[model samples]
Target: MMGNVDIFEMMANRYDTPERIQISKATADAIRKYLVDTHDKNAIDFGCGTGLVGMNLLNDFNSMLFLDPSQKMIEQIKQKIDDFNIRNADTLCFDFEKESRTNLQADYIFMAQVLLHINDVELVLSRLYDILNVGGHLLIVDFNKNDEIVSDKVHNGFDQNNLTELMTKIGYREIQSKTFYFGSKLFMNHDASLFILDSRR
Candidate 1:
């Protein structure tokens, strides 16, 4: 079976299609609603492939880190950052689930359309919780459960209630979750909706 990193590396060059940009825009907009004027804050975009979502939100933070498992994806994001003359952002290629590459800390950690790709969701969430500074926020954007979507590698989707319970178990507080966007044929050609869940560590 092809690992997630290899799969993403192969798709890196062609990953930023029009459809994807649209989806990212929607996700970013939803995230923006919950954001405050934190010009001095730092953020990390975990599983930040090509930085479509993270790049759009760079102005919201003082500095941003784009972290992905695929080297090619990180390369693409670096190119985008340079091409746009975005000085506040940097890119790193690391598989957070398997190893720790940097001892960086952040006030905010954003994950958009990333949870569905993770197999051990609880473990990943726990790791994220540990890296977040006290009172830091973890913002997650992922699809709501859809029975119509089936896959061997990706999760079918997520149940917000179950996910909230897991987040609580991981020591998060002030958890707030809501469905933010809906699209037709969004997930594996099945009609699906996306949700944004924000929690403080």
Candidate 2:
């Protein structure tokens, strides 16, 4: 496992930040719309941070498994869910690098801002493909590194061209992307994007 201790610590500290709060709602809404339109009920929030995505999902989804490598983050999420009185929720502290060790399968998976922290993006994508049911959708939201405003070195951003190529190479089809502002600017000066990828047989 790639020592995600710092990542979890970061979440524990900044789980209530304004930027995180704002981005979570927009990202969750976009993801929720895609999942609902496809009639997907069973879902998982991969890299779920302090359950921000889970918080947005509570009203629309009845059951969801929240998975993260950070125990501290999961604890924070548990607190949030408890405060909201949300039920039928579960949390797992495991690494995508070790996903083969777990049995995680769902109709839809929401992963926000987690891709940038991962070094083996392609490998994780394959793992996600393996775990999702047929006709499943994977929603990814991250800052595109190519965007001029993104100043974080840890962020591994992807432009539309590279993202499409990666998804296609992984045997994913029906890939679509949309750009949105997720940070300091209201007009999307930050190069963030939301991707919807459909699993293929």
Candidate closest to the true structure, highest lDDT? 1
Question: Which ten contiguous residues of candidate 1 have the minimum total lDDT?
Answer: 95-104
Q: Write the per-residue lDDT of candidate 2 for residues 104-173, one digit (tens) a residue.
A: 7777777887776677788988888888888877888776555455433344466766877887898788
Clashes of each: 0, 1
TM-score of structure candidate 2: 0.82
- Candidate 2: C-alpha RMSD to true structure equals 3.4
**Model 2: how far is 75 from its true place, Å?**
0.6
Candidate 1 Cα RMSD after full superposition onto the native fold (Å) = 1.4
lDDT, candidates in the order shown: 0.88, 0.71
Q: Write the residue-wise lDDT of candidate 1 on 100-190 in tens digits.
A: 5447789999999898888778878888888889999999999999887768878878898999999999999999999988888888888
Each candidate structure's TM-score, on Cα atoms with residue i matched to residue i, is 0.96, 0.82
